[model samples]
Target chain A: MAGRATPWLIGLTLVLMAAGLVGGLWLAPPDYQMGDGFRIIYIHVPSALLSMVVFAVMAVASAVGLIWRIRMAHAVTAAAAPIGAAFTFIALVTGALWGKPMWGTYWVWDARLTSELILLFLYFGYLALVHAFPDRRTGDQAGAILAIVGAVDLPIIHFSVQWWTTLHQGATLKLSGTPMPVSMLWPLLVMMLAFLCYFAWLLMVRLRAEILRREYRARWVEKI
Target chain B: MDSWHEFWTMGGYARFVWPAYGVAFVVLLGSGWAAHRGLRRALARVASRVRGGRR
Candidate 1:
């Protein structure tokens, strides 16, 4: 079963995390502009990237749930909401930490910042909505609409730095080999992989929990 | 000790840097544990009900 793979996946996550943390913290060179403080990018970038990635997961699942009336699809959206929220929180705080030294303020009315904050609140709203009704399916319907609507913020968050004069920097690792050097790039790629692995482990665990909750009395529960 | 202190300092952004990683680590691990524990409890509940129903 999928959940059986979780322990191994989590083990992989831990091992990769230790290596990536070392690579990110000590091996990666300081940025020319930000000095050693720029090491925060290792965590910040992955969290920020995952925040968007998780939302995309939530929105897609919600869409499929609504379209197909699939209970499992809704379960995925529900499971992903809080995970996505945590990632958004990490992104926000780390962004502020990096911002204070670089932009001279912990926050601003920057379009990117505002859109990302809205993303956090969207996750919160979706989560709250998912449990509001006595019938899980009803709540799932409501959350699906919100997740789809809130998805508009994703493109806004991605392009905010480009679309407006924002303090936030644009994407660092474009495919063109344009911006960052190889030394800085490897840790980033590793950290991103680590984040995905961690998310996968967590998601599998959450999915089984959701299944058990939804199907606790079913005979299949005893077999597992 | 001196090199350790320097590493901990994070080039003087220790306050911001450490908390960021700390929060992420805590939340990630905490949530994973919660899911694992939740599953165990739910399964136990189902098992108990199954046994009781059989009797």
Candidate 2:
């Protein structure tokens, strides 16, 4: 890739990822009721959180791409598509898995799950729209419009469970409360940090490749 | 690893938990592979373009 990610950033991301994994796997206390099955929370919650974060990021980048006519911004939004889709898919699958054991069913059209599912569809639709266009700039512009429009669903997804009687559990970890016991909270936090690092690493790698792809004619790309 | 065994056992809730982890595992692995492939392909394309221009 023409764009080089700093070694320091990559190293720091790995360190955070390692800490998160260790904290999540060993340090966190099992749930009083669900026991280790609750361990899945480490991955599930982070994945869900990141999925939303990625969408918001793509939306913002799309806006930047549209407003400033920046090819790099368009590249970022494009690179984000599949990664966001993957994270959303993980969240949905893991949620369903967790739900089955706890809720005694494989699937439920609960508000939170349903809204999250819609988010996934939005990602897919955006991808489809981007690819459907013959002109690259037109594709980026159209996709950007869709991304901005689809962002309306994000708030609904975040607050869906609270706003509706859903099978999904309410947020256990919040800024205000003491949080689940230190043991559980530590791992959960670690996992969240790790997931964020992982996303950074992925995004950088993806963005670097994208920059090279879209800016092949650029001078710096010739050397790197 | 015995961890796999422990995972599937799930303390008698084997079916529900295993599938969840299994799917997550598959998705992560698949995405990792896809990302690697994408990076490599993009690098190759850029490399060739750079080389072709020089020639």
Candidate 3:
């Protein structure tokens, strides 16, 4: 791995993330109803979206590792557990905050909220399984299998609100709708992009660390 | 309440709104710090092992 490439990738992510945060937090318009507090949506929506994206990435990486015996893939899947868990935490927190104002309660047992809670549990379960085995390789393989099995629950998480009775609001920033005012939309989009960049940047750093740990005997690990 | 409008503005809801934000801020900072620390520890362990392997 070229030393230059990693730095460049990280640098690009930082630049994109900064631009996105500024656009979302400062430039975007407050919601007509929620006012200034609606700004949390920038953080909230991205976290929700990334929670799904990160898990999907982990599952796919684990599959690759199992099928092709690519240790790099296993490392990637293992590295993502905590990051995805963090995103899920953000989503749940922001949701509760927003709900306090809008729904008149700090927490609710609605279908959407419950399902999101389950997603967080799933992430924790995968992490726990990884550490359960006495052998590290056994842990990795077991965790990978768990990731694949857990992926089946993702679709349920996504559609739970639509199918069941829930207090959570439906999606607002769809591609087809007349977009929210430019003020609001700009900031939301910027925040979403910022979060995506941040996720990628963090994932790469974690994966690199995992690579080093697993291949510590190799010359590359020594140089790093 | 000063006025109904002010109350809806969370002049009264300040307790709820501020705590939500506070909780979120704490969670974000804590997680980021944890991840950074974990990675650093992993790197250090790897570096140590590499040195031992060389010996």
Candidate number of the best lDDT: 1
Candidate 1 residue spans exceeding 4 A from truth: none
Compute the DockQ of candidate 1: 0.57
Error of 1 at A112 (Å): 1.0
| Model 3: per-residue Cα lDDT at residue A164 | 85
- Which structure is stronger by lDDT: 1 or 2? 1
lDDT for residue A200 in candidate 1, whole number 0-100: 87
lDDT of each candidate versus the true structure: 0.87, 0.80, 0.77
Taking chain B only, the TM-score of every model is 0.84, 0.78, 0.77
lDDT over C-alpha atoms for residue A58 of model 2: 92
* DockQ for each model: 0.57, 0.46, 0.32
Best by DockQ: 1
For residue A92, model 2's alpha carbon misses the true position, in angstroms, by 0.3
Q: In angstroms, how far off is A25's CA in candidate 2? A: 3.7
User: What TM-score quantifies how close candidate 1 is to the native fold?
Assistant: 0.95
Model 1 C-alpha lDDT per residue in residues A132-172, reported as the tens digit of each score: 99998889999999999999999999999999998898887
Model 3 regions more than 4 Å off: A1-25, B1-25, B53-55
Question: Candidate 2: where are CA atoms >4 Å away?
Answer: A1-18, B1-10
